[model samples]
Target: MSILKDKNILLGITAGIAAYKSAHVVRLFIKAGANVKVVMTPASKDFITPLTLSTLSKNPVYSSFTDEEDDNEVWNNHVDLGLWADVFVIAPATANTMAKMANGVCDNILLATYLSAKCPVYFAPAMDLDMYKHQSTKASFKKLTAYGNKLIPAGTGELASGLVGEGRMAEPEAIVKFIENDILVQLPLYGKRVLITAGPTYEALDPVRFIGNHSSGKMGFEIAKAASNLGAEVVLVTGPTHQKIENHLVAVKPVVSAEEMYKEVHKHFKSSHIAILSAAVADYRPKNVADQKIKKKDTTFTIELEKTKDILKSLGEIKTNQFLVGFALETNNELEHAKGKLKAKNLDLIVLNSLRDKGAGFGVSTNKVTFITANNTIIENELKSKANVAKDLMELILKQTHA
Candidate 1:
């Protein structure tokens, strides 16, 4: 799904032959599930009718501060429009408009809104090849970028003039893709790779039977989504569960046993800057497996069990620059035991969850956790949905790793 879904996109159009293309841009934004509002420079209406943009955007097009039909009876609030948008985009931005934006000249509502906007700003320049190559235009580009504005570089194609060069505003589809990718790459975790383990590993007793826990993989799935949304590429090593992820940033690796999970984690750990182990791996498995499913016969039957290898401890032992994080689900002495495990496993951080707390642990959607840092710093979080908890955890990780 597009990150633009449910996003408020404020689009500004300036006077240029490329203004006609802004109609298609509005349509594209609407098709991508964005609520779009069009703001046009007064001269832009000559190239493309306000009705055309308004109809496509499904919102009234604003040109001046007040309606020209009335004697300035109604006021248009550029500040409100600026604050209401999740992203501000100026497509087909003429060199004149770009100059005004770069110099803080707010002669129009669009310029005023750009000056007041707190959200990310993106501008697509459209002009003749010579105008684009001019030193003044290049200076404007540098200034805008330095002010934290993203530039959607013009394409190379035929211009309104007989000449063809790199001065065409990007196509609507390219603009959308560029905006989506830019938004992600600008996030704090944009360049970091994260490895996460989720769900409960199943120890097979036979082909038809296995030993597993009540873990639903919800927590780990939430963490993966959170990290992906924050622009990190995630490698999710998961045990058997129904949880699914739609983010393209996350790559899922399915495993059914602790041993399988261990191998997958180690495979991706070297490249991962952060490793979060949230899987509920079985502590023990049958020492010997039966060739076939044993039929129930005796009233009291028992199978010999053997301890499974500690995947978290193993990672901790070999840890270098990777930030190792583990989860401890304890019943009693939760903090003490979690701290011990944090130290024993050489973990940089440990999340402690108590089964004694209602709405926490196992298959539930909510969790209450305490974060214990390697430096003995503790942070307690109140009960929250697993998704919210994942966000909090992600924030902590971002603060620690500075990625």
Candidate 2:
């Protein structure tokens, strides 16, 4: 039930002495199944090293605005970072950072990224007790909140300055709960069951090899996480992945092939309010399979092809109150083909991807998609991280689910 599961949450650590506690915060998010990334303020570097945070996060630590490591000077993309995060969390926020947030200061890379962010930003302030209660500090916080940022609301306890009153940074566990609880309250699909299919289903042509895609199930896993965050009780049917499922609340059922996926999907999908078929199920399979591996490399060899069951169409016939979503991958005529599937399959919506796009389609960290509904309506967007794309998809479904 952790809110951080499969979430792309970026942690921004400022120069406060409390910066030491960010390690625990990172651990909490990681335990919640989030892909945690850290941005350390130069001052924060004094309190904690990039190596330490990087080790916990398992992602690169971002610091300088123009800093680059490789020869090409192709630096970490701050614009991409700004657009990638589902939520931006500034833990151990200092008065300097708070004041900069209030006045639009962009002195550091972290601050610059904050200025450029498009997602929800949250801050947990920490300072000396008296400094926290100052009129100036209060006003800065008020202004930042008015700009649509959220306050994680610091705790009251002993301070680093040796005086006991207020200004303690919120505990990592408490911050994790704050995020989860907030999301749980706004779940659009609350009480509604969601069934999703993810990963590449291996359609066996023979024992030695089978037709499959490079889907690691990351996208599908992300969808399940988003649905759970939005309050749906999710059932994830995944093919395979090394990544662990973040939310224990969502029931996960694993499968290996199209038939397996269909069986598991249909069993639970009967009660599901929504279904997103993101699995790369084989459209065609060998008509007959050899029991043993077909040895020898033959330049010319052919296997009879047969169509696999159309899971979406089959479900559409039995669907009553459920919403059906399909996915389309095309190299040409992308929109026309996607719209066709939306109508023919009786899908409420279809997500379209073209291999022509750089970050989209199979085996990419980022994606660019055009969401097409049953009415032939379209909502197109530029490339974004898969995390953001998943969140966007969830929001649209929520609009429909709520409506």
Candidate 3:
């Protein structure tokens, strides 16, 4: 998959003849698997229509702070648009727009969004040769770069003024390639291998029935994606789950019973640099399973149970260079029990989830967790999407391992 896959790109279009190329830019970003939204200066519309941009991006193109036809009743929060983007790109950046950006001018929605943006900003300048070489334009470039905005240097080619010079906007294809290469090479886990287990394993009692838990496997799948985003090669040993992951770096091994999960986990564990066991494996399974479903003839039926293999504990016993992590789900004595598991499982870190916390527990997208370190230190986290929680977990893992 492209490194830009799933990325939120906010494209800003400014008034310039080169603004015509922005349609191609949006198309390329979409083709590369990025979700794109366009913001245009009012004057830019003369060169390129909002209808065309919106049609290509499949999202409303914003120019003004509110709908021009609407009264002052509606407003577009510039800060929200700024924060929603992972990266902002202003292709065909005019000298006027560049000056406004460098001077803190926010009269237009595009400039206001730029001022409020928390993500990286990239601008490609486009103008005639003399205008591009002007001292003011040069200063704007220097000032914006000093403020941490990336400037994609203009190409040398024929200008719209019927003059050949170094003021053409970089091609759409080149700009996307540049960003992809830059982002891919900076991933934190670029060379690491991660092994993860997820979902509720089923222990067969009969052909028609089995034992399982409420786990939706969302947490494990989120962790796998987060790790893959950081450039890790992941082996995900998952139990029955409706969840799916599309990252090319993650290789999923589906399993049914606890024994199957255990075997799959072990098969990839030794090759991993980090191992996280998040599967809700059964503690006890039916000692004997019938080949045929038992008829409902008896008033009461009984089946013997036996302990399943301790996968985490066994990994702890044989661990070498791997940084082992485990999870603890508790309702009572949460911290105490979590700490006990952190030590008992020989884990370098343990993430504790409390069923008592609202928005937390199995089958949900959100989680409230506490992190217990090997040194007995504790870090509590507020409720967050499981995806963000997974990000925080990976950050901790990187810190502990690299420390």
Q: How many clashing residue pairs appear in each of the predictions shown?
A: 0, 1, 0
lDDT of each: 0.93, 0.86, 0.93
Best by TM-score: 1
Residue pairs in steric clash, candidate 2?
187-230
Give per-residue lDDT, candidate 2, residue 211: 80
Q: Which lDDT tens digits does candidate 2 get at residues 1-403?
A: 5766677999999998888899999998998778888987887999998899999999989988655566666576677888889889999899989999999988888988898899889899999998899998999999999999989988988888789888999988888888777667666677788898888888887797888878877788888878877788899888766545757558989887788888888898778889999888888888898899988798999889898888888988888899999888899999988988888888998999898999888777788999998777799989998878889998998776662
Query: How well is each residue in 1-403 modelled by candidate 3, as lDDT tens digits?
Result: 5678889999999999999999999999998799999999999999999999999999989998888877764787789899999999999899999999999998899999999999989999999999999999999999999999999989999999999999899999988977876676678887789999999999999999998899999999999988888888899999999999876789999999999988998899899999999888999999999999978988998989999999999999999999999999999999999999988889999999999999999999999999999998899999999999999999999999982
What would the TM-score be for candidate 2 when compared with the true structure? 0.59
**76-122 per-residue lDDT for model 1 (tens digits):** 99999999999999998999999999999989999999999999999
TM-scores for all candidates?
A: 0.87, 0.59, 0.70
Q: Residue 145 in candidate 1 has what lDDT?
A: 95
